[model samples]
Target: MHFLNRGRKLVRTAIALAATIALAGGGVTATADRASAAPVTPSPIAQAGTAAVKGSAKDGYQVYSRTSEAIRYTRTYDGIRVYGGDLIVRLKNGKVTGTSVGLAKPLSLSTKPSVTALSARAKATSAFRGKITSSGTPELFVDASDGTGKLAWETVISGWQPDGQTPSRLHVITDALTGAVRGSFDEIESVSGTGNSIYSGPVAIETTANDTGFSLTDPVRGGGYTCDMGNRTSGTCAVFTDDDNLWGTGANADRASAAVDAHFGAATTFDYFKNVHGRDGIFGTGVGVPSRVHYGSAYVNAFWDGAQMTYGDGSGNAKPLVALDVAGHEMSHGVTEHVVPGGLTYAGEPGGLNEATSDIFGSMVEFYANSTADAGDYDIGEKIDIRGTGAPLRYMYDPAKDGSSHGCWSTTTKNVDVHYSSGVANHFFFDLAEGTGVTAYGTSPLCGSAAPVAGVGREKASAIWFRALSNYFISSTTYAQARGYTLSAAADLYGFCGTEYKAVQASWTAVNVAGDDFCSAGNDFTLALSAPSVAVDPGTSGTVTVATTAINGDPEPITFTAGVVPAGVTVSFDPATVTAGEPTTVTVTADPGTPRSSAPVTITATAPSVTRAVSLAVSVNSSAGCTGTNGDDVAIPDNTTVTSTITIADCAVTPSSTASVEVHIVHTYIGDLVITLLAPDGTAYVLHNRAGGGTDNINQTYTVNLSAEAPNGPWVLQVRDAASADIGKIDSWSLSL
Candidate 1:
């Protein structure tokens, strides 16, 4: 089956054709003239991955960013890059400080493709029946959505859709070596509509007056033009021409009647983005989008195929699908594709985001036009009687009104059709712009346990979404990530931790999207350790500074505690307790007979209702000598996992020998830490799993049996901080074999 056919079925099934009626009265007649068109030019192929890193850069690895302070890297093996393999390194003015990786392990994969590119293309074409207008060379891609990577083939096939009027651009991904189709989606975004001379009503449209006469082409705005397909399946469409300057009679009886709405929609959508968001045009390059009307016999849909917009005549040719929102929705698809490269994957959560993006701008365009004929509202496709009951196709205020649409987010959201899944984001945008409960637009209800949200105004909300779409979003972005990026965008446009940022957070939460509200002004206190980690040798002592600052409500006393001390180690706080804005010193002492190993310690501070933790490292050097240490400072952000590796070289041990590890960590709330030791052979031993309760710091040594294992390879000590609010780092560690 075709990818978008499912969505068409949903719309057709839900549509109640009992209330079909004429939208506007009168018809504008116009004569059509044949015009020559330039040959179609293929779109330039995008480079598969980021520019190759030079100078000692390994194959399948690329640098994501670089600055005097630090550099970020990602893995791209054999031309197929990891989707979320981002590694960030911190530097102190040019000196190396610390490093953190997005992936759990290094990327390693075979570069050879077992299936040929021709075979991949053939599979795509066979899956969907359509004339091939354009095809791109299949490229190797890695499926890394689940943290692990798998190689696959990504192919693009475009041509006339099986529905005829709706063009198709399908992206089919197949397992490179197995020839198994992993997933597929249509790139062209579309919406079904009904017939009738639909107009936003009396809007000014730009026209070009040539030597012959005036045409339905706008020379003042990106050279966009509206043409009549003449109800033919094949051949060039003629541009609408008129001897008089005025066009369209607000009725679908004449071919030029629908052109008025189509032309006006294009202009209004362009102005909305340009004036409100500072964007130049749909592609942000002042490029025009051609509009083709009257496509196919009894057609009932409109779509945007990458470069242009096409509308079909409604059932019985009595209605043209050139409604304002429909036109704006179609063109906005082009904008999204150009704004976010790869166009949001066109399936799953990303696909829902893509569709929701168009719906958002389409509604904005209607508001921008503000024509009395079709008053601006949150209702989508309301003017078009596609549902036959005079009801809109989807309601942003309550998506469930359409039956199939999801009013809120859930785990199964991505499994639904993009159009239905889009309801979650659409509702989010509405709530963000208009708040919950009664409003000028409509009443919005909260999802799950979300609190009622206050509107940030459509103007500011649209700006935040546009900024995120243009600058922050990626093809595989999830709804949770959308919340983060939008928050980031709001921060960039307004200010961090401001009202705008708070509204963005509240809006997403109202749609049941779980995210951190870091900008919230409710935090009572801030906790930090003077250093990321500390190192202490056997028979020696190390001290770290624990600082607490007042925020929101303060001046409360904070009690200090210790967590997971080594067998031969003891930890104590100099001031044990202090009020907010005071600093305390944590002293960790190791016994002279301490075993040669690494131990992780945690320090926690607790007030009336606020508690935080940091991690520290304690190492006991082997009296026999052969140990390595890493003192790099790693930042463990809240609710994230981070790893620090210590390599022990030139060390050999017997096969049946036991190994000792000394780990030191400086973090708040050791109870939230999960530390593990990963050997070279992939054997992992859990050192600590929130074992310290509410105590803080990990200054301990662990002894593990290394029998039947090799002891001369890189060992990794992984530390994960699994809760919110508390954060710390892996200070240093030593290994003895």
Candidate 2:
């Protein structure tokens, strides 16, 4: 079938892209798209290892016509690439029937009944239903595959409802064959399944609450639990525990379920952060941040307001996105706040880094959880379905692969959407921690590169980076600072010249951060000014600018600030800005508070302090022309021809012809430029003149060929100047062959 796939282009081009290095140190196999071959022959079935059973044409029609819960199954036995086909079935009466493949109206085949047939309707029903051992609870064992047409990733369903509905309960059992917990014995019920949370229920609540230090209470259906919201002055508002007599039909019960989901989410998030980055909690210490689920009435989003995390029920389209990754992401903000207490004020590079930290950790958390109900993957926010497109928020393999993300950066990288903008650093982290080729980590083919990691694992790298952020990097940090701090951290943990340090350097380099030169060379100047931090809220626009230091020999004191702010805000920079030096402070102010308080920005400097010209001029002079007389020749025979001349350039020049000559010239270029001379006899002489000369003389020269008697004609001399010519030059030429 000609099914169209939109993600083909980006997925294919992900591997061959070029990467730039950081000044300082640093550093799509498309198998699924192939066409399938046509089936050669179609015959009857033999032994049934896994029966490829086909239903009759009437059965197939009934599958579409019947309202029963029986689901229809279709399998492309060869591969998923083929288009149309038919079904052949054998009935209980030993009657054979064939159905033509047609979407509108299928053709049916008549079958000839056999004399020896099984006459029993009871036996027919028994074939579809597998043997069941446990019967009481909400548990059943079928061909596990029979449960869903084929295998499927499990999804938990939990929540609350009215009094008549069944109370939520637990169910767990192992598959008879695989021993996997494919079917659950527990069954729970609520009033409305729409409001039910997947991560709630007994097991999740108990396990999650125990994992976190928080305590759990009875399923307070419709009751708002009381918890301290920290300081009220800073907008840290707390909710009072109240069991309202009148609540949404079963929203309160569902909200309780949401609370359990939140708890489980917190547990997974905490474990991921600690296990991955060695961070104790959001605060690096053992301080756990409180997450209140079902914050307001259908408040679609989940956010961390500088203090604690809050989750809200989504509208009709989406569910409450308290998934592990999302919870980890929101909680990461609190971690960032604790780490860099100054907030996202220090905009630009640092701000971008801060935002990216959350995304990176979020992906890491998903990777750690590794739950089938919510399998770990690089795709961000897929379970939440925030976009309703069945895709994800951002793709790590190719951020732009989903068409909603930025993918990579351009000169105007700062102008993209913040969600997309976060891609720049995300790409850096991926390429840095992982190298340029395909990785063999057994991960989904999403990340095209074969090299999952360059030198060390992401765990070590993240650990070092976290240490760097907590110990070395400040609130107003820049990409440069991050590179350095990370390198330093890696160095401290793995040794200065270890693979981890090199990988860290390489990753930043790939992301286009010129690490070696992020800082001014030779100039030891510190700027209190750093990259501004940012926060992107649902319906608000905020802007922040980061000021740059003036280079001593900067043709002019150029005021640097990012311009052409995105739609959300009218972001502006200052001097409208330049802080001349110490004591001269340049302030980057955001106008009219944003819908969300924090928004991220990344500022980089294209110009640096020190300037040194690396241009050199070279010159050389030797034999101008050669003259052969009878004085040196014992016999100047009749047809005998003699010639000699030395031609030289500013750099070393070799005589190319049988006749030798050196012509004076300048080698104002770097590297080796070739000199060639062709003799009249069609013979050519060549030499490679290496370019570096301290005294501005011939570094190396050679007289190619010498002949007492040579053909007498104007010998052609060709000088092929070397490509890399920054330190030397080429001048006059003379030749005789």
Candidate 3:
């Protein structure tokens, strides 16, 4: 999940102008830009600091338009680009208007890797088992998601899942120096569900009539076809073909009975996304996804394995995991991954969002189909008695009815399993679409002190969520962010201060998610950081920008200062001050020979009436290495492969030396990756195959005995993505000889 790039224009209001005028303080003057017809002067604020801005004046910051009225400035530290460090300055006809900062403070840390690329790969391998398909070279990354940053190695491992046929792509994050696994997540999204001796009963399905008679394939809908796994574990399954135009008898007694239900489910799901959301297909392309039924003997689950959908038979081969909602649920996983960047990070709050996204759409698909055999409802997996007690797998109307799922948000919400954590969002969606108390779906109880929420209707609710998922929300997004993004989506579709937007806020409140009321204060002044934290090497320095933006108020002067500084580190600001609606640079310097450690530094921007403080993660390290990286972000176009070259000129390493190669790639689907390293002599070493199945990004190192090849020439790194419909990029790479 990532924030989608938008090019909409912002509407300025009189309140914003007044706020700017009121906030301007000493040494700050308000001016108007006659050309742009907006304020051109700085708002009220004071500045204090001694650190002079260093570096070439022309090389300081580069501005690019974000929205029509906002221009973003990229941040750097001692010449090194700061990841996630950027500032957005809103302007109207070249006048200072408002600003939004991405970085909390400058980065001050060590730029060294203590762990070898080979060691990082080994650690990743141990954590990710199964058939090793593709293993990418590890690259150094600044981990700043927690408001503190650290140098970590990210490796992408792809291959067949433990079940063999199911593809698995696993992203492993390791401590760069310690080689300890920090975290990992699978890219494939799956949900447990099932079928029957034709439990769905007779349903209308579209099939292709071929020379071999009617086949269980929908030629009309992206050539989608269903095959039989034959209760086996490996190899390609055969597509179901019948001598006649008719399919299975509505009974488990016939082998094709389950296929009928599976086939119908796929068709309904495809139609749901296409007709309801205007999506072309699962991938938003006119491509059909393959569905395989009869997966393992008594497997009792279904999953969207990154590339295709697979279903299992229940105990006694009596239950096939292919219900209407289950089919929609599994297929929606594909839509979510393809729609969102890195597909919601597959863990924590994002993971729950992923699951809930599927549930929401799955239920919607069921409703769209309106199958009499399995009516659309808030309950999931109710038709399939997976629990043997006629109870559904989950209750979206009142998630807590399941005993483990939470209906409201809490501090511990992220700690629960993704399936349960999803309850919070699921309940919120239900309340938003149908309201509280008695309704068509059922009675939805409010959580905590939240008031009753009015319904926005399912159509509007789904549109709002789909818009948010596609346009807002990025990887590492928290529930609070979801609330904001949903509101933004509603604003885009309905109105900024409209009923839909307010209902979006109230729905989240009903789920106990707070602070979303910020939307209510339209045109209010605000502060934000592009990145919450940053990392720097010892003896080196980094820079961050502070920005102040007015939603609907006058630009004011804002004072900037460092709240906390480590003993060995000093913080300074360029110009030592700033006015609201303008960006100021903050530089952090670490003394030479400083001890390596992590520190949390806070940067505060204060005005006469309001003050905001943001946290920064500073890490100092002692590890060192020789590395090379791609200066610009390379785009890997769909269905095409790209290469990035890392030239190593006069290296002192001998031909017989064992060299470690670290490659870092940021992509959505690791299963499509095939990475190779070419020595100076044109000798190619396969570092990774298309192994990771559906996992996001590749970060791992490969160690090879380059004793036979010279290390002084230009080495080329090649990357190929076998499949289409998804794309990614090679972030950077390093060669430690």
Q: lDDT by residue for model 2 over 29-125, one digit each (tens)?
A: 1111111355532222211001123222232211211012111122232232111122222222222221111111111222222211121111111
lDDT per residue (tens digit) for residues 35-145 in model 1:
225554311101111111111133343444344544444445554555544433344454433333223223456758888989888766655545778888887777654
Q: Candidate 2 at residue 114, lDDT?
A: 21
Off by over 4 Å in 2: 1-254, 274-278, 344-347, 437-455, 517-737
Tens-digit lDDT track of model 3 for 463-491: 99987776555545678768867876797
- Superior by TM-score: candidate 1 or candidate 3: 3
Please, what is the whole-model Cα lDDT of each candidate in the order they appear? 0.67, 0.39, 0.66
The C-alpha TM-scores of every prediction are 0.61, 0.39, 0.63
RMSD of each predicted structure: 18.0, 33.9, 17.0
Report how far residue 223 has shifted in candidate 3, in Å. 1.8
Which candidate comes out best when scored by lDDT? 1
